[model samples]
Every structure is written in structure tokens, then in C-alpha cells.
Target: MLPPRTYVFFGLNAVRILGIISMLLVFASSIFVLVHDVQAVNRFMAEASESDMQDCDYIPGSTVPNQPAGVFWAVVNRLLIIFQVIILILSEVGWPLAFFDRFFPVLGSAFGLGALGIFQALIGAAILSHHVDDFTLVTAFFLFAIGCLNMLLGLIFREGAKARRSITNWRAQAKSVLPSAEDFRPAFVRPNSSFVPSMFKSGAGEERAEKSGFGFGRQGEKAAGLKGFLISKPLESLPRYAPPPRSEGSRSNSPEPQFKSSKYAI
Candidate 1:
């Protein structure tokens, strides 16, 4: 895919084209109203001079307030357009000098374009509202539509720019957070035998001593010898006492005495 800057470049040009068209419409509508009003004033003067009724006073401002406002906005719009055009020409021509980085310095920006779009839209709406029944209505309507489209494009570009900036900032933060290969190294932990309980380790040491035919010390050798001696002895060697048998004919009517034996006694 193409880069975002390329898209923005094309989009800005589109806005400029639409803006130029809207400006032309504004000029046409404003000129039509001014010319019509001027003609009306001339007719009224002629009628008045030709012995017309004194009550036939023609007031120019009484027609509609939108005519004057439309003219005012048209003038302002021309100036703004001229300013942007000059900046664009200067930036482009001085590109090799690196004097300016952007094509349309201020109005080329997202917020600036949005503001311009809003201004044009307001002007178009005002003019269209007053010229509803006149031929100028068509031009005013077109101007209004173009202005709204420009506004939408401006807002979309602005959001795109914001997203790009946010992504750039996030990437910068992530890069700062990541550790460098030079500064990062993996460490492996080794278990210390000193921290282990002797009871759990003694069995392994005893087994090793028996296999090697050598003990860890005198205590280990004695423990090994004792364990070997016990394993070699027979179970019959332990003495067990026998209880006397009772006969059914002996009617003593007495309970047998209970005896508790120790663990080793059995």
C-alpha cells in the first residue's frame, strides 16, 4: 500500500479543487444578487424621475439580508484562497532550499482545512437560504454541497493524522521500554545443597557410601553397618510369649486379664 503522506497529498489537492469550485459558485451567486439589486435601483430611479408616485421608494436592503452577507463572505473567501495559493507556490518553488516543508503552509493542515470548510459551509447555507426562489439558488446549493464534502474530507484527514501521531508516540515509548541486547543477559540459578535438610540428603549419601565401599565419615559408616546387620537378622530371633489355653469345663465365671505389650516386646 501507499504511504499515508501520499494519500494526504492527493486528498488535499481534491479539497483545493472542490474549494475552487465552491469559490466560483460563491462569486457567481454574489454577482447575480448585486447585479439584480443594482438594476432594481436604476429602475426605481428612472420611475421616480419620470413623475412616478412618491410612495414608490425602493429600498435595496429590504430585499433580503443574505445578499449583503453573501457579498461579504465572497470577498473574505477570495483573500483566504489567495493566501493559501501564495503559500503553496512559495513552498513548492523553494523546496530545494528547504525553506518550507509543506505545500499549503497553514490551510494545508488538518485543523486549518476543517476551519475553512466550516466557514465556506456557513456562507453557502446563508446565501442559499435567502435565494430559495431565485436562479442563484442552484449555484448556492452546489456551493453548500461542495463545502460540506470538503468539511467531511477535512475531518477524515484530521483523524488519520491523529492516529498516525498516536502510533508514532506508542512506538517511541515501546522502544524506550525494551531492553538492549548489550544490556540484557539471561541468568541461570543453581540450587545450594547447604539449604537442603540433612534427613532428605542422608539416604543418597548412605547409598553412595555402600556402593563405593567408603563412608562419608565414622557416623555414616556406623549407620551403614547397623542397617546391614538388622537386614541380615531373621524375624524368628525376636522372642514372643505364648498365652495359656483355657478349657470349657472350668466354670470359673471370671473375665481374662488384659495385657498391653510394648512395640519391641511383640
Candidate 2:
């Protein structure tokens, strides 16, 4: 058994499909009127005299004086307009009830196109009554085509809604099946102890030195004064003749022996 929401979705889709079919019907009817009826009307108007052209009513069984074809096309055009209006209303109502998001614009477009179709139909009828031209019929055809496109867009939006719903359902299902971060566990047991000490433990000596106000080298002695900030002479600037310092052990082990020059006797 299907869920209630699924039923609603299917119902909305059915309404949308019906709207598209009606729009196509309107488009085809307009084309028929343009090709068959409009041409026949134009031919009759062209052949008839000025006296015959003045009256809008069609006379039956008379070839030169009547335009029954034009009257029939006008009637069919108006009927199509009525059908388009009903479909537009259904679409506007159905889309809002089905989808809770971002469907108003699509509804508005359909409404606008339906209105344009009616307007064009009326204008075409008026023009056909008096002055029938190629431009009139072409414009009417184009307007009906736009209405069909609006229906096609609505169908596309319906498909998009279905896709969005499917994705949302998939995400919900995945979230239900997958474990959360807190529940995750490693395959192997990890050691709690580390060879390297923590920063907090390492900083203990430095903290004690800071509290005693003595530097790192000697304990019980204060830090160096501002003279420490002065730069010492670089190695290259030191006197070359100066001897290197000797270690305490080496100095203590030295024997008190007199040195003899190379020119003197040993």
C-alpha cells in the first residue's frame, strides 16, 4: 500500500499532466484555426465587395457573401480559451497544495500565459471580423505556442519536485542507517601513553624559573640588566692576535719549564 503523501503527489502530477494536455490542445486548435479557417476567411473577405464585408454575421449556403468558416474558427478559439483558463486555475491551486516550496512563480507564469492566450484570441477574432492579415494569424499562433511552453515548464517543475523528494528520502534513510561520530570505534586498540611529554608538563620548569625571577643558567641569581641588551662584537671584528681561552684542566697540568729560542743552545 502507498502512503498518503505518495497519493497526494501522484494526484498533483495527474493534474499537472492534464494541464499540459489542455495547453497542447489549445495550441493545436489555434494552429488549425490559423491554417484552415483564417485562410478561408481571408479568401472570402478578399472576394466579397465592400457591402458584403460590413456585416459581421455569417450567411449560410452562400459562397461569396458568407464567412461561416471564420465564425466557426472564432467559436473554437473561444472554447479553447475557456479550457486554458480552467487548466490554469487547476495548476495554480494544485501546485501550491502539493509542493510547499518555490512553486508560486511557476503558477504565475502559467496564469500570465493563459491570460495572454485569451487576449490574443480576442484580438485575432476582432481582426478577422474586419481586416484579416497574415500578421494577425501568426501572432495568434505564437501566443498559443507560448501557452504550450508554459505547460511544458510546469511539467518540468513537477519532475524536479519528484527528484527533490527522492533525494530527501534517501538522505533521511542514510542518516538513520549510518552511525554517529560518537559511536565510531577503531579496529585496533590504541595506547593511552606517549613517549613525548605534554606541553603543560614541559612548561613546569619555565614557570618555576619565571616565579623565582631567575633565568635558566644559574639558580639564586637575578636576570641580566639592560646591559645584556647591548650587542657584542661579531667574531670577524675581534682582534686576530688574541689567543683562545684554555680549559682549567689544561692550565693546571702545565709544567714550570723555561722556553729556549731556536738560535740559543739547548
Best by lDDT: 1
TM-scores for all candidates: the values are 0.38, 0.31
lDDT of 1 at 222: 73
Taking the tens digit of each residue's C-alpha lDDT, what string does model 1 give over 90-115? 32233332333244333432333455
Residue range with the least summed lDDT across 10 consecutive positions in model 1: 183-192
Residue-wise lDDT of candidate 2 within 49-167, one digit each (tens)? 86866664553222122554556656565566556545454544444434423454434422333333344345334434533335445554544454454445445554444333343
lDDT values of the candidates?
0.52, 0.48
Q: Candidate 1 local accuracy as lDDT?
A: 0.52
Output the lDDT of residue 237, model 1: 39
